[model samples]
Target chain A: DTAVSQTPKYLVTQMGNDKSIKCEQNLGHDTMYWYKQDSKKFLKIMFSYNNKELIINETVPNRFSPKSPDKAHLNLHINSLELGDSAVYFCASSQGTGPLGYEQYFGPGTRLTVT
Target chain B: SQQGEEDPQALSIQEGENATMNCSYKTSINNLQWYRQNSGRGLVHLILIRSNEREKHSGRLRVTLDTSKKSSSLLITASRAADTASYFCARRNAGGTSYGKLTFGQGTILTVHP
Candidate 1:
């Protein structure tokens, strides 16, 4: 069984359009995160949620928003998508907060293409 | 912004050879983690070494951390063709409210020839 899953593995949309990617984790993890991998393959954290509460918000644009309905789900919504948004979006989950020894498990990722 | 920077952005090795990747980060950290990502796939957790720890091992994978240098190294022994992938090092920022959040470095792509 897949531990972390994201819906619409491939998303192709035009500029000025809004889109949303859904992510769900069944590991009963308390923390979930959204990461963006650029063309150069640099992965950066965009947002994080713990137990349906927003915990970390990077310097991402206001056009991008993350919502967590519950501890098991975190969704990302992008408004007015731009060509620069073309990249891979990954969803990950971990067992606890703080550093220590928690390991993150990533999903298959959603390839977003903006034209 | 990227917190960690990995050396030798790309590596090519023959099967049975050992591969080593180095990661250096700025500022202190609670832990350092290594992950592997196959092309077009999500990342897979390889191993994590805490700040207090000096060395750790998992199977053919060995990880070493040096807090004094704020760097870490991952060594893969007996690398196989299947070991071809991008390896990334992520560090949990030490201070501020950003604890537990991981900042990843530019990955090192390793190609193991059969």
Candidate 2:
């Protein structure tokens, strides 16, 4: 069984198309996050959700939105995608906020390709 | 966001040799974590060392943390081809505002010759 999973491991679409990626974690986590990894293998945080509330959004474009219906699922939806949007998007989850102990569980990133 | 840097961007060693990768961060952190990413795959959590703790070990892996230096290091003993992958260190800041968000380093690519 996968601890964290994402649908459509690879997505290819035209520059103007809209697309979405889904993520779920069976580990019973309380927090979920979205990160984008560029071509240079640089991963940066895009969004973070904790207990169904948006907590952190790091200067991500308005075209990209993240939704967390429940603690176990977080989805990313992009409107009017662009070539620059082509990157591997990763979903991660953690049991709770940490100072003593906590580590994240990551999904098998969705590789998005914008033509 | 960029937390800091990982030195020796690339590392190479023989199957039986040991491999070491170092990471440094800028601000204070509650804990430091190490992750491994194989080619075309997701990242896997390897180990974590808290700011208060100095060293931790799991099987063949050893992680050392130095809060004073704002640095951490991962050591793989008796490495194998299976250990060849990109290793990244992430910082988990302390406080409620962190929201469990991790700031990851650039990463170190390790290649173990079989």
Local error of candidate 1 at residue B49 (angstroms): 0.4
DockQ of each candidate's interface versus the true one? 0.81, 0.77
Candidate 1 wrong stretches, greater than 4 Å: none
User: What are the TM-scores, per candidate, against the unseen true structure?
Assistant: 0.98, 0.97
Q: Per-residue alpha-carbon lDDT of model 1 for B24-46, expressed as tens digits?
A: 98889999999999999999999
Candidate closest to the true structure, highest DockQ: 1
User: What TM-score quantifies how close candidate 1 is to the native fold?
Assistant: 0.98
Alpha carbon lDDT of residue A49, candidate 1? 95
Give candidate 2 misplaced runs (Cα > 4 Å).
Answer: none
The positional error of residue B44 in candidate 1, measured at the CA in angstroms, is 0.5
- Candidate 2 structure quality by residue, lDDT tens digits, A1-115: 8599999899999999999999999999999999999987888899999899998899999999999999999999999999999999999998887566588888999999999
Task: Report the number of the highest-lDDT candidate.
Answer: 1
Instruction: Kindly list the per-residue Cα lDDT of model 2 for residues B35-54, writing each as its tens digit.
Output: 99998888999998888899
- Judge candidate 1 at residue A24 and give its lDDT: 99
Query: Chain A TM-scores, one per candidate?
Result: 0.97, 0.96
List the RMSD of every prediction in angstroms.
1.0, 1.2
